[model samples]
Structures are given as structure tokens and as C-alpha cells.
Target chain A: MKKSLFIAAVAAALLMSGCSQKKPEVDMTKQETTETTAPAATEVDTGVNSVVGTEESAGEITTLPEDERMAKIKELEASAKKIYFDFDKYNIRPDQEPRVDEDAQLFASDAAKDLTIKIEGNCDEWGTDEYNYALGLRRAKTVRDALAIKGIEESRMVMVSYGESNPVCTEHTRECWAKNRRVEFELLP
Target chain B: MRFFLILFMGVALFASDATLEIVKSTDNRPSVAIQDASEFGNIRIRQKFFRLVMGDLKVTAHFKVDDRYRESDYDAMIDPLLKDKDYLFRYRFREDGEQRLYLDAKVLDLSSGSPVFERSYRVANRARYPFLIHRAVIDFNDYLQMPSVEWMRRYVVFSQYGKPKSADIIVADYTLTYRKKIISGGLNIFPKWADKNQRGIYYTKLGNRPVLYYYNIYTGEERRVITSDGMLVCSDVSRDGKKLLLTMAPDGQPDIYRYDIETGKRERLTFYSGIDVSAQFTGSERKIVFVSDRLGYPNIFVKRVGDRAVQQLVYHGKNNNACSVHGKYVIYTSRESDNAFSSNTFNLYLVSTESDYIRRLTASGINQFPKFSPDGESVIYIKHYASQSALGIIRLNYNEGFLFPLKGHKIQSIDW
Candidate 1:
């Protein structure tokens, strides 16, 4: 059992590296990311053992389901913290550094290697739609860069901006707005 | 407090071949008395139509509406011009015991004691009765030879925020009297009319990838224009309806893009890292104007369609956005105070491309999403204060304003 776990872990790391190397350049203008570009990470099948094992063991060990895996993923997601920003600004606050660091640490660890970090950036009910969407994207990109600098692969990170669309709080008060201006860490397997 | 958006001349503007004149009212709006024949016996329908016509006349700013359901009616034969009224409009609905509404409208020149115009309109149905009132007002406005408020009958496409992460793109008349929900479900926003005929609209749906979709309201067909990584919006559609002015975040930042609807080709217009959004084609699409924060705060900026030279458009407000263009005129919303948390007091200002004839439209309470009427005689916008939303109209020639309430949902933005 220990040897099988070792082989599975090593094999997963190899697949992650394989996928990351083929990933397109980050700064390419989206117009050029045409039909020929590789499928996005979201389309990738996220079955853990399937991602780890070869063609032969992929069917056997991968099919041998572990009921605890989904619960474990949910547990980790529950602990995943959110990073907040100031009004009309996308810069991650200094006080949020530790929370970003924690997410980075989780993304970089072996247990979370196969996990895809979807950083949802948001804003309060202020700025224009296009501007807020840009701000939220900037915030998510800032968090992704922080995670990348802390040893997480960019391929394992996802950036989606909600702008002022999705709010965790409903009140119009400053406290509620601040709470709404945040980047939530969602882990997808 | 007045806002003077002094024009800057660092970069020369392309000389306009089209001449623009600020046509002021010839005289104070022709005072008019409206009388409704009470013998129709359908008091409810008559009053409803009566109020709609009176409100329409008041909004045109072309008349001092003397008929506010007053007890006494003005005599059309007498010189009402002496009584401070010029035109006398007496309308009577002739319902022939059949469940149909037909209005006989006649406008009498109170000065000459002569009938200027007379017409009878058959309402299509009860749903279209308001249009009958609008037609009467249009005839009255046109009889005066002033720019008609016929455009007021056009539909305004707007998106209003509802339940968390959801919005509905609604198409309503200028008065918000008639509304139809065109798109709903999930974060769809930034609905811009693709044509002057109000056939289709372009909006963005927030998903894993933000996509701009062109939906034909009549045909019920939808086509994806483009899928952007961060955000995308169709801000303005060109006169010919073949091209689109879009705000897209393609290179990790939001910038303006001109898209050819037929060819499916997009030309990146602005290459700014901070933000460039809400772009519109001005003066025949040769000059593109947009909002940018490159100077560290939101301000209006303009550049020619193919020229690389970016010129400062407005120099008064820190956050001047929500702009609309009609010919040489540009109307925008400017923040009044310096409180970043204070998003409550943005006002609308109108300026021309050739010169800075800055006209302040509103005094207070977040007057935003200003779109000019097709004739450029009136401006329609959203009035937001406290939790209430209202549709506001600025009769440019009259320098007067009127508002109608939009209850239940908060308006996000509007386009006509």
C-alpha cells in the first residue's frame, strides 16, 4: 500500500509538470488564443487517481474509489481564506499577505498539487462595470502572482473576476462593501 | 456649484465638416391648454389617457401645460395667447360601444383662432393606448415646428440588478411606462442597442470566460461576438450597424476595441494598462472618445479612430464616466464631491466636440447612464438616490428636466 501511494504521488507530479510546460505564454493577447490553442484547465478531467496512473493502472486503481477524497477536498475548501481590497483599488492589502501566503502554501504543498486554485476576484457596488471587471481581474492576477512567487505553478491557478456581480454581503454600509471587495479561494479537483 | 470643463488644446482636433448650432427655444415654450371631453363616460380610461397626454406635453418642454385636470377648459376660439397659452388641444375618445379606443385630437392655434392640425388615431389595443397619447403629443410638438419628441417613443435598453449575481436586461419606452424583459438569468449586463431600429442588443455574460453576445430580440437568435478573459462590453454601434465600439480586457487590461460585425474582425484601439472603457464613436466614427484612468483617476479622453494621438477631453472632474455621444455632442456623468465612499452625487454634463459649451444637466443625486435622443434634442438617463431608481429626461432645448420612477429593481446602466 505504501509503495502504491508513492508511485501514485510521483506519477501525479510528472503529469502536472507535463501540463505546465505546454501551457501557453501568459501575456499573449487573447485574440491570438484561437481555436488551435490547447484546451483550458477547466476542461481537464480532475479525477485524482486517473491523473496519477498510466493507461493500465488508470482503469484499476483509479476506479477503486475513495469516498473520503471529496470530503477531504471540501474540508480544505472550507478553510480556504479570502483576501480583501480597498474601495476602487485592486492591490491586495498588506494585512492580507498572510492569508495569501497560506493559500500559496496550500497550493505549493504535495497534498494540494493536483488541486486547481480558482481565485475569484470581486469589487464593491461602485465603479463602472468594465472598470470593475478590470479591477477584479487585476486583483485576481495579483493574488496569482503572489502564489506563483511563493512556489505555486501558474497552470494550477485560475483567475475569474466577478466584478460587482457576486457579493457575499448585501448591506450598502462600508463594512459590507469591504466584505464584498474580496478574492475568494476556491479549490477545484 | 457649477462645473466648467475647460477644453484643453495640447492636441489639435480634426476640423469638423458638419456644423452644429445650439438652437435655443424661439420663445418660451408655447403655452397650451389641454381639454378632454368628459362625455366619453369612460372616466378611468379617459383620465388615464388624459394624464399621459398632459405629462407628455409637459415633458416636451415645448408647451406650458395649462390643463392639469383643471375644472375649467380654455376656449379654443378665444385668444389663449393672452391668457398665457398659445395652443389649445382638446381630445375626445370616441368608443363606439365596441371595445376599441379611437381618439379624435385637434390642435387649435389660440392666437389665430384657427385649427393647426386635426387627426384621429385608433389604438391597437389597451396595451398600446399610451402610444396614442404619445402620438397626440408628437403632433402637437411638430405643429410648432420645434424638434419633435418623436424619439421619446423609442425604446430604452437597460439592465437592472436583481437577486445576487443576477440581472435583467429590459427594454422600455423613454417614460418607463411600457417595459419588456429581453434577457434575464445570470450576470448579463451592458445591453447596447445594435441598431437604431431596436432589433438586437449586445451584452456580456459573466462565466468562466466573459463573453459578449449579440441577441436579436425579434428573431430570438443569439450569436457570441467574442469571449474575453476578463470583461467585454459593446459600448457603441456605428451608424451603419456594421461595426461596434467595444471595451475588452484582452491583454490583462481593459481597452477599447472596434469590432466589425460582418467581418468578425476586431481592431484594438487603446493600448492602456490601467483602464479604457465606455467608448463611443463621435462625429461620424472618425473620432473615438472614451473614459480612461491612465492619469490615476477616471477622466474622459479622445483619440481619432486611426490616430495614435490621445487628447484630453474633459478637465473638470476626477471621475467622469457614463458618457453618450450624438453627433458632435457628448454627455457624461461627473462626480461632484471628493469622497471616494460618496458615490451618491454624480451629475451629467453636456459638451460639444468642436468647442466647450459645457451645460450642466443635473444638480444632485447620481444622474447617470445619459443617452441622447436620436435627434439630440433630449437626454435620457437614470436618476439614482437612496434606494430608489428613476428615469430622467433632460429637454435640451428647454433646459428643463422631468423624471419617472422605476420601482423594485435598481438600474445598472441604460442605452437607447
Candidate 2:
């Protein structure tokens, strides 16, 4: 009985915030009924609110409903972070071809046409600075070339090389080094 | 007259006390022996610590590391000699952690069999253990009768990785101890100290727009100096800090250019259509040593200011990527093998400016970014191992080598 009262309070607070658009009234009504039947209803609502808060803070989310366009953009951003490279090499790995294809498809889609994507190429700290810088440029160019080949215009995509400047992990192990050498994509309006 | 003589005697006694005379000269390097204490749990850890200390001393080229002592023989040899003569230096590791290390060392005068200097050095937990050892070595050297070079205690500038597309400029001791991030928030690379004072560093920050940025090490103030369309990297700064030698590719081909910091005027130094980069100033501001591919292969070239005539300094290697200049000596990296995949053994070579005398300083591994010590007797370069990278120091006169493996991540570029 107490859990039901807590769920109703949270549901009321979320509706009163008036921050989230698109069916807040409907979600509040659904929560009012589910709060009585399910014990996990409050937990689910909290998770949804946290995700919504993150998107709202990023300021990239628009008033679009949950549709295929937004889904494709998220899928592409996930694929963008999946860039892989060969061992001790900065060139794009052959195994990452499918992910590159997926990224290219997202860039060509109508929703992503106006978005600016910045691809940052990086390398393992195994070589000299000048060599790594050149190698990083090659990696970024390879991805940019893939996008161009897939019908994405060149103007929408920009490429830069961080060389070996940024490493996600500070460990000296091989696994960390492999992860260090990659290309990441950031989307901008 | 008698009272004046007494006063003169008093003055003479004080003057004699102020002067120190070395009655004996030892031609040999200072001998040091290290043994693991039984109380320390692991013998391997003790041995590793001893090796690190010995390596640090050997690289300084001032101490003669004696490996004649062992942990098992400590009871029979070191214990008896602990009170005897000829024990120049002694060290032992007490505590070890993932980031912190404790070391206790003692120095003795062999002739008198008396302890001269003793101290315990501790460093924060850092990935580079050899650096902690290096600091201990520096202290040991300073405690000795003579210290070789004072610059051993200076901070080393290099890049460390935090993420796949993120590397920050870091300042650390020669042994990579006491590391602090000086530049981050973007991809920062090729960190070079703007001057010997170590007040500022210039590095390339690769973001949406690639630009060369200058960062004050103390205040954390950063300013964008210049922006380029394709590539931009600051190779070296003049000793006086008035000019910077940069490799920029604003017109599509990378070339060397001289930029005056005071006037904001950039003069194209090299008009080559091919790649001409990595320009380092000689002792005098009139000449520069840079790497160029005008001969269809990357090699070191030297040219005087206001002179169109360029002289090739190195003709032995195919891909001599980087170089540093000190006085008349030029140390450069040369590719030893032609096979692309087979780890092209890159070694360092030292050559004279006036003659064709080329001396190989390093024989194996991928060594690059060779910088001369302020005294010009030593050269510090980056040594690439199969798994890690190290800051290697070579004493030219002593023919001794020392290396401090970098902890944290791989080092991109370093300047003393």
C-alpha cells in the first residue's frame, strides 16, 4: 500500500515537471493503473526519467516522436563508436566493414543528411608522433571514403586525426593498446 | 707586533678550514652493490628494484654498477663489509605498492670505511617505478663527491593516453615520477617546451578545427596560436624563445616555416614541394637541422639562415624521421631494415657538423626524438619496446646507457 502511494507521488511529480513532451499525460494515467498492479512500476518509471533527463541535457533531442528516424540515428552513433583497427596498425580493420556499412547507411538517411559528423582518428602509442599523425589521418580518411562511397555527401562529414593523443585506457597491455587505436564519431546539428 | 702575529694566525686557521683538498683521486666509477633484505617478502621484487637503481646510476655515467653482490651472499659478504671499506653505495627496497614506493640507500667512503650519506626516498604510487628509482639515483648522485649533470632532476614533457581519441600533455620527472596533466580536454600531441625555463609548452590540439596551442604549465592558461587547414606541428623552439620552427601544410605540402613570436610574421623557410619537416635549431640561431625528402628519402639536412645552399648531413639511412642538434653534433633516427612489416629497427646516430664522422649511439629498438642534455654530454631519446616505450639517456663520454620505461601510456613526443 505504501509502495503504491510512492509510485503515485513520483508519477505526479514527473507530470508536474512539464519538461518532457509527447504523451506525458498518457504516461501518467498508465502509471496510475500499473502502480496498483505491479511492484516494479516505480523503478521502470525512474529509469525512463533518467534517460529522458540525459537527452534533455545534451540538447540535441527535438520534439520528434519515437520513430524510425531517431532509431536510425542512435544506431549509427552506436556503430560509429565501434571502429576497429588492425594489430599495431592504425588502418581500418577489414572486420569492421559491416559496421562501417551501417554507419554509411545512417549518414545517407534523410534524418542524418543535415547533421554534421566529426570523425576523430586515433592510434596506439607505438610509433613516433609524425608517423602516428599521418596514420591517424589515413584511418579517418578511410571512414570518410566509405561514407562517400555509400552516397553520403562529403560536405556533411569532417575528418580529424588525434594521432595517439587520446587513449581510453591507460594500461600498457595489448588489449588496452588495441582499444586506444580507433576512430570515434560525434554528431552536431 | 706580537699581538698582530697572533691575529694573523687566527685568520690563517679560519681560511684553511674553508678550503677542501682531495688528497686522493679515484679514477674508477663509484661502485654500488644492492641486496634484497630477507624481511622483504618477494626476492624478485627486490632484485627488480636493485636493477632499476643500478640502471639509473649507470645511465648517469657517473657510477660504476657492480652486480657482484647477490641476495643469497648478503649474509657472508655485505654484512661483513657493512662496517668495512670500499662500500661506495648501498640500496634496498622496503615497501612497494601499485603507485607508491619506498627506498633506503646509503653511501660510504671506501678509504675511511665511514658512512657518508644516507637517506630514505619515497614516491607516490605511479606506473613508472624506474622514475622513483631515478629520483633516488639523482639524490645519490648529488650526495656523492661530485654530481655529473644537474638537469637530471628537470621535468620531462610527453603525452599520455586516457581514451582512444584522447591524449593529454603530461609533465613528469626524468624517471616519470610525479606526473601531472598539463593539457587535456582535446587531443594534444607533440609537446615541446617553448624555452628552457619550462614555463610554457606548444603542442597540437586536434579538435573540430586543428590548431597549434600554447599552454602555460603553471597557470593552466591556454591560447590558440595558429590554425591550419591540413597539418600543423611545432617541431622546435629557439633557445631564446623568440622564434619557432614549425612544419605546416597550409598549401597542401608540408614545409618548414619560421614564425616570429614577437612580430607574428611567418617566413617560409623551405620552399620544397615535398615534405620538409622536423626543424631543430643549432646552438646558434643562424643554422637549422631538419628532415626532408628532397632526395626521394627522408634524411637530415642543414641550412644556414639567409642561405639557399642546403647541405645533406646524413646519407646512410632510408627513413631518418627525427633529429636533434647540440653544438656541432646532430643525433638522428635511422631506419635499419627495408622490410615494411618486419619491425624496422630504428636506431640513433650522432654525426659532426664539420666532418663525415657518424657514430651510432643506439644499436637496437625504435629510438626517436633524440634531445641533448644542456651540458651536451648526454642524449635522451624515446626507446620503443615490443610492449612499452621508455625514456633512454645515453652518456656520450661515459659510453653508458640508461632507460626509464614510461608508465601510464605510450609517449608520443618528448623534449627536455
Q: List DockQ, one per candidate, in order.
A: 0.27, 0.16
Backbone clashes per model, in order? Answer: 0, 13
| Candidate 2 lDDT over residue span B132-169, tens digit each | 56666777777665656667767888876566556788
How would you encode candidate 2's per-residue C-alpha lDDT over A1-189 as one tens digit per residue? 999997887777777445445445667788788877653323334435643334446656656665656676667576554587864344457788888888887776777778888877777755465645655655776787777888888788777667666667667677887787787787766
Q: Please write out the lDDT profile of model 1 over residues A3-91, one tens digit for every residue.
A: 99989878887787667554445424442656577645442333443554455544444432455777777778878789989876777
Regions of model 1 farther than 4 Å from truth: A1-74, B1-27, B37-49, B71-84, B92-104, B109-116, B340-344
User: Could you give the interface RMSD of each candidate, to one decimal?
Assistant: 2.2, 3.8
Error of 2 at B266 (Å): 2.1
| TM-score of each candidate structure, all chains considered together | 0.78, 0.66
Q: Which stretch of 10 consecutive residues in model 1 chain A shows the poorest summed lDDT?
A: A41-50
Candidate 2 residue-wise lDDT at B205:
81
lDDT of each: 0.77, 0.71
